[model samples]
Target chain A: MLEKAIKGSKLYWGWIGLLLLGVATGFFAYTFQMKEGLSITGMSRDVSWGFYIAQFTFLVGVAASAVMMVIPKYLHHYQTFGRVLILGEFLAVAAVSMCLLFIVVDLGQPQRMLNVLLHPTPRSILFWDMIVLNGYLFLNILIGWVTLQAERKGVEPPKWIKPFIYLSIPWAVSIHTVTAFLYCGLPGRGFWLTAILAPRFLASAFASGPAFLILLCYIVKIFAKWDPGKEAIQSLAKIVTYAIITNLFFLSLEIFTVGYSQIPSHLLHFKYLFFGLEGHATYAPWMWVSVVAGLLAVLILLFPQNRKSDNVLAMACVLVFLSTWIDKGMGMISGGFVPNPLEEVVEYIPTKLELLITLGVYAAGFLILTILYKVAVGVKKEVDA
Target chain B: MRANRRKFLKIAGLATLGWSVFPNLLRASEGGEGAGHVRWGLAIDTKKLNDEVMEKAIVACHKNHNVPHIPDKREIKWLWKTTFHKAFPGQMLDNMHISEYAEKETLVLCNHCDNPPCVRVCPTKATFKRADGITMMDFHRCIGCRYCMAACPFGARSFNFYDPKKFLKSEEITTQFPTRTKGVVEKCLLCYERLDEGKKPYCVEAAEGVIYFGNLNDPESEIRKVLAERYAIKRKPELGTFPSVYYLI
Candidate 1:
């Protein structure tokens, strides 16, 4: 069985084919980015950030979702996540990889990314962001590799792996928290200037992250005949429901505080985001769509009957993920700069080159995640024996 | 006693080393780089800042800088015209709102603040304040973060949504400064480059006698002469961003 698994795995060729296609597309996009600079993407002065940042924000939530599985398996002694643990780790690896790519593509000079570390600015939040992102990426890699190695051996896992697993629980939270701080720490952007942004970020992250995981589990069950358990999905759905509620509650608090105060500066960005203030209605439609989608997603997750349906549950996760992405990533960052201190509305739209680069990065991340998961699945067959 | 003397010497030596390590700390608590150098401040005289002068100054500055006025109203503005009263929304002239001259506006641009908010918010240290109270951006280092835009209450920053240099007149085009790609923000630099050559700012030179061009620090400068003899005011002193541009009414 081990020899056959190594010689001709069912999923291995499919993974390799997809990976090659992704790499080719990514290379083409990268070449375009090099020639044209960042003008290819949509980003303007008033809306300095756009889709890439939104994607980064969304991926952080995905990365943090690893803790959903890790916490249950290790701390609560929930055996339901035993098979699903590798899936969570693989998702984290893909998500973090995407997060880094988004940031690189967003930069004006991608080569100068090293300067953030080499010429470290202790005063800048970006310096801390660099530290946290790289740290989180490495932590996930170490944990995933060690856990998988132990799982394959079928031993109770080494004692050292225990500490790393425990460490990952908090580290997962730290990644999203650090990402939140990146926006909240900025001074005058009224929408992002709240003390509750970190909590809100974590809440939303846990919600969408777990939703994606549950959906992924169901997907693999149908396609690969891998049944982690129905109990795990039900348990994860409950956690996700609560997380979504918290996310919405926090968002409401932000809106209420800003709206009730009637402060012009504080109200400006939100007004620009949700409802058009004057002629600047660019992101207003997207903002409203995200809000409506988010509310609907929560409702769907809240109902057990709807969550039981594989199609509805999967679709809810997809919508929830996208809605959160638009809200946290796109609107949040872009809206922060609108009605800029000078009261001028500078519009930022990402360029075509930027879009290509972004697509390339996504391909790279997906390719990595796919290959890693295939290897894990192949190795799982050996361990089960 | 010998031990005490050695300890005292050691303490003194450390103090000297500390001062040497932070060289700037050795300087007196002067507002600017050079001690006794008067910090420049602006006082706008709303009466003289009419639409004609505003247009003239803006056109001159734009022409000189090759700032493109993309016909799209939203995209237009290098040195645009804005109402003087609206510009200084916080302060009132003689306790009465300056509403009568609402139709006639003033030219507004970057206010080279003594403590600029834009400089404080820059993540990459791209936007910085010079020793002479000039807030400038190093376009090369700018990562298009737009934090400076959010921080600036003045709405002075602009992002290069496309290659802006492409809009330049054929003869006006130069490769001295890389045309900002889409993403990075750019704004008025107060023509610091032109100032280095002992030339008045393009706006001031083009304004003929409408706008004064001289150092505010030197009391003997034309700007100081105008302020000493005439009634002048700044846009928003209440914001605590001490601007270096003044207007004479």
Candidate 2:
């Protein structure tokens, strides 16, 4: 066992040590937040949501993006996807785990989380959010485990797993769409009060999430000496390019509506988010950066020459991922509350506890991804690919 | 100690679910134990709002209820004022130009909507509508999601940012209720506890009849009579929230 462990030295102990460090730091940070309340974080009344939730929202899309591999490999009988399908499933486990962790840290009282279960309100979008999040997590775990068991036994996957794999395609859409609904269904916050938000969420998720997975494929090639095939990478790049175009289109639709209507309440929110309304310029820089990065990513992916280059493709993927991470994950929710209910501009900065806890959560995700990918790589090496 | 702890837990648990599920059940179970049957509602005469009596009513309710005035102005609001035009955009007064009085009148607390959007959006069922048509927020169960604040159309909710006691005077602190911690949203409950004590709302009593407290359900009630007799209006009536609170123009 020790020899086996030594053989995969980079994947085993190094990954474990990183996870332990993250868990330890997160424990301390969570304890502090619990002792001092949410005030220990940078969130205020106007900006109630921040980094943790943004990360949660972004990661859910990444988790759902696993469907890209599952759909093609199983449904379409794409032989190319067979070699790397495990990577997507494992990445999903990591992403979903982090999504849950973000929600926990974002809660004012993490201990009382069961209150959601004890007193469920069907009328509330939040109640459904909990349901969808948990359901998605369980679905991924079940499918991933069943498929892996088949791989281990050198037998065909179970009959039931096919239905579930099929169900998860639309279910994957629902998880992120429901998340967008949690914001869009709100009555007064004009920032998210639109019919288009759900579609927008799916578009951006497809853009950034597949980009992340493709990057993971490249990373595996570099570190683990496994190639996910250039064809798969190119196909993913095509999906991302189209998704980015749609994502940008929806954002433009929002801008046009706000500008055309010229309603003070609606426009003020967009103004504050994009260009700094009434001297509230904190998020303005981030918004502009997101715009530039997003546009550049789309252009890079669309241009065959750019997408063909590994470095350029990797850079484009990183930029698009972060842009959506900022735009939808952080800025969308937070910007709604600025020029608050009372029309006053208030700033939100995450506290040290929040920052540390967020770092720990990211570390936890990295640890999971690293370990899972190792197992997947090892399993694949044994196969006659 | 164990028994007391158990009892407290039971009560707290029941209270948490009660307001969300069956608020009216308590009134029926408790056998209407007040000064006769009362379906409480408030009537504000904005013209009289500037009167010292009305201001005293606001202050009286604030003091009796231990409502904190956290000096960080953005976070501070239990009772305050706003122009009619500012509060309701589309509604037009008959004599807009000549009557400068309409501009100066102080708009008090939430209208206490019969169909509250705040209650609809709360994830933990922390803010629920009482059977008596009062929208009350339970600070203990609130997860500080702020979805309630986002859902409220009237902009009545205020979140406590810093510890409220830091900004309040010692005398301002009352034993009847605990001051809120940072995070959870809070707003006026229309002195429901005071109404339970066989007394008019502190606001009404202090206002010396400037603020009328009565059963809006009963046609013979003071508020109903006032609504019928005077030209009265509710804020943002178009939204169809059907607020029990009425203001005499």
Candidate 3:
């Protein structure tokens, strides 16, 4: 099946070439970072985690959103999703791989990463995150491959595959939940201390993941000349609509609590992200863009006529993706660290090397997604013919 | 022959279980010695801390530990000075008659919490709580995730963003304690090395009478005596970290 990836059009090869270039550039930057240590990045003691961690947090939600397709197709026997379910699982595979890569690159001591496994402490949320994330990656790979293989053979998938498929539903939820716990369980980080963080993570993940998938479906329509089915795409748009609304609602709840209570520790983080803390307002513009785009996306998605038009729907999906990307990828991490525990405002800005490394990680994820999607689409075209 | 083999297997299984449990039992006994017997603590009298005394204490600890002077906000610090309002945010009221105390410089260091959030969050157990109530770091085992830095409420922990050895002159580097490498989290260990050798922490000795270090568990200890006589407060006590460091206002 990987042979399909190798035999793509000139355009496909060019895209692959660009991605490989990104990977090379990132690798070059990473070597420099390794030699110079994390000082090459913009992180200070006050804001210890920067861009790498934020991307990791955002992509975990994307990885876990594969469950949205799994639940309706396997559990409820939804036939519209049958053709697109493989795409979702493959996306999970790519996203989880990126999540893992981001973590490795972010490490101050990447060589000593095995210490997490060599000396596992059950008390640590990171330990559980490692287990569940790896487990999820394997589960998706096995389930996606076996099922796609059965489809190619025109035979039923093996009975043994069912339990693993069922397990993946909850396993998908666990990946994002544990990632949320990594922040929420921390004692001093008031921004992440809310119990609603896990639920909010799921809501945003369901929105952004499906929104990205909707965009991918259109790309497949143009490039592969394959429609993933209008019904399937519409269903995903509905999921995105509801999930983004829920995500916004969760944000409001956090705001209300912080504003009403008037607690400086919790309120200051919000002030830093939305307005400005002390004199620094680096993230305020990005945060407002997320908010306005999210609201506009909801309005577009809520109307049936607008959603019925493929062009408008695609526009809305892009907005949804951009909105959640900034919310989680830009705001989530630095918001927690800005007003350092001692009430000092220390801001973080990513260096060029850091941004290059980040782009490299995203390129690596897309490379995987491209290959997997090519294989799946090739098989689907063959069966349809 | 069957009966003898079964009996031997039983004994072997019991021995294997005992070997596994034995280390935990030994650890429990070792911890028990200091559990209720010797909880190391410090009490700082802010009134007694002048600029000269605080500077001397900071210099002494840094000299003893081989901590680097990086000349940036990223500099590694075992002990440092900050204003009273900065050290204890939200504790000072705007209309208070003692508003001048808000600007007063006070010395701060690792609190060595009784229940350390850093120990709980560390994936490799690199940062751990000692039986004697000092939070300790195993630098070799650290993977440099900085979760400990995130978990610490007092901003006490610092990550080695750059190799610390570069900032220290060879002659000035102390042989008394090991200097840290790049990509690890470190903080004051409450001078456990000196305490082991029947000596006080460098800051305690340097501060003259401003800083007090002794066993909080011992009723007759000097720290307890100071706490009894002075109105002292711990930083972020509401967080339930139960910090061993007390501040005398």
Candidate number achieving the greatest lDDT relative to the actual structure: 3
Model 1 per-residue lDDT at A16 = 60
What is candidate 3's lDDT per residue for B5-122, written digit by digit as tens?
9999999999889879787886676544456578899999888889999999999999989999988767787899998888888876574666978878898889999999999999
Fraction of native contacts in model 3?
0.82
Off by more than 4 A, model 1? A1-23, A26-33, A161-164, A279-285, A303-312, A339-356, B1-38, B63-78, B83-96, B101-104, B161-165, B173-185, B194-200, B208-249
Chain A accuracy as TM-score for every candidate: 0.92, 0.94, 0.99
Residue B111, candidate 2: alpha-carbon lDDT: 74
Candidate with better DockQ, 2 vs 3: 3
Please report, in order, the local distance difference test score of every candidate based on alpha carbons: 0.73, 0.77, 0.92
Cα lDDT tens digits for candidate 1, B1-249: 999999999999999998899867766453433523644344445566666776777877776666776554225255667764456543433345554654446777777888787776566778887766668888777776655665665667777655665566767754443445544677877777776555667777777777776667888976788888997766566667777877676
TM-score of candidate 2 chain B vs. the reference: 0.81
Writing each residue's lDDT as its tens digit, candidate 1 over A41-103 gives 555444557778878888888888889888888998999888778888888989998998888
Docking class of 2: acceptable
Worst 10 residues of 2 chain A by lDDT: A1-10
The runs of at least 3 residues in candidate 2 whose Cα sits more than 4 Å from the true structure, single-residue gaps closed, are A1-7, A10-12, B1-30, B33-39, B51-55, B73-76, B82-86, B89-105, B160-173, B178-184, B229-233
RMSD of each: 6.9, 6.0, 4.0
Off by over 4 Å in 3: B1-36
Clashing pairs in 3: none
Per-candidate DockQ values are: 0.25, 0.38, 0.72
Instruction: State residue B26's C-alpha deviation in candidate 2, in Å.
Output: 10
